[model samples]
Target: MAQQERGNRSRRSILEAAARVFDERGYDAASTNEILASTGLTRGALYHHFPSKEAIASALVAAQSEALVVPDQPVKLQAVIDLTLEFARRLQHDPVLRASVRLAVEQTSFSRPAQTPYEQSNATILDLLRQAREQGEVLPGVDLQEATSTIVGAFTGLQVMSQVYSNRQDLPDRVCALWRFLLPGLATPGMLARLRTAPLPQTAPQAAPQTAP
Candidate 1:
């Protein structure tokens, strides 16, 4: 048990260190040596765990995605709003996310061995949008593929900008404004009305059931 716990801690330390390096140097420029220096881990130790820099990046992406899951109870629009705001806030304040995002944005190509997290996160967000559509929450005429891409693009762009600017105070407001404008048109009437009102649910709401008609 102690060994397992120590292993987990070591892995997390490596990831956090990698995030710092990635944020500071970007993906193309970040080096395993830099990550090792940041974590104070030996080359052999790093290889024992992650095996490659790309693997560290993939772990970082997985950590980020896990952190973003919404609650499974009745969700108020305010909760969603708050959740998004918190996510943006983390992207701005969390060194790991900031670095990973910086790495993602700075990359010019989307080749494999480097595309795992990027592809996975995009797929996850698209799946969420598809669920919203099936739940009578998405507006009609919104093409699932296009809307998903747009939404992901907008959110990703926001994170990248926040990381780059580092001088903005209205990020939450900016993100909220963007979301309100874009989400309303895509929501069903019932969902739109609730979202506009920004009602606070007593508890976390269930994720809209995902089923196809």
Candidate 2:
């Protein structure tokens, strides 16, 4: 167990060191040597965890979408909204998340293959939207799959734009604006009126009396 825990720690250190190097120098310029130098670990240690830089990039890309799990809410639509809000906040603070975005942005210019970041994001939203629909929070005519696509695509665009324009400092506000625009089309009138576009403080309670069936 101790050996396994130490291995996990070593892998995480390599990933974090690589993320920082990728964040600062970008993929094309970032070297495995630099990543190792940042970790103060031998190249063998990094190679043991990740065989190549591309593998590390892929891991980071996958990590960005999978890392944040919002607290569940009785109002499923609000949970969806909170997911985006939480993601926006994470982007402002998490270098791993930002580095993932950097690799995605520059992926086409380099050897990194096309990735499934959107597909993963879409699945999460689709699950929430399905739950919302079952609870009558979603509009009767809304296509949940289409809504999922739009929400993920719009959020992806906003992440890039906010990073370019404001270094993602305004991302939370931008995400709130996104929810406001999207909710009108996706949510039932009662849900729309009840949902809060802004994220509640982290310390705030998450549960609400379940909405009427």
List clash counts for every candidate, in order. 9, 0
Report the Cα RMSD per candidate.
6.9, 6.3
- Per-residue CA lDDT of candidate 2, range 131-206, in tens? 8899999888888898999998888889888988999888888899988888888888877889999754653343
lDDT for each candidate structure: 0.63, 0.79
Segments of candidate 1 deviating more than 4 angstroms: 73-83, 108-118, 167-169, 196-213
Q: How many backbone clashes does candidate 2 have?
A: 0
TM-score of 2: 0.88
Residue-level lDDT tens digits of model 1 in 1-213: 698777777787887788777766667788899889878777998998988987787666655565565534243333345556656655545555655565555552354453444565566566666666666666778887786577567877776565457643456666777777876667776776676423233233423221110
Residue 3 error, candidate 1, Å: 0.8
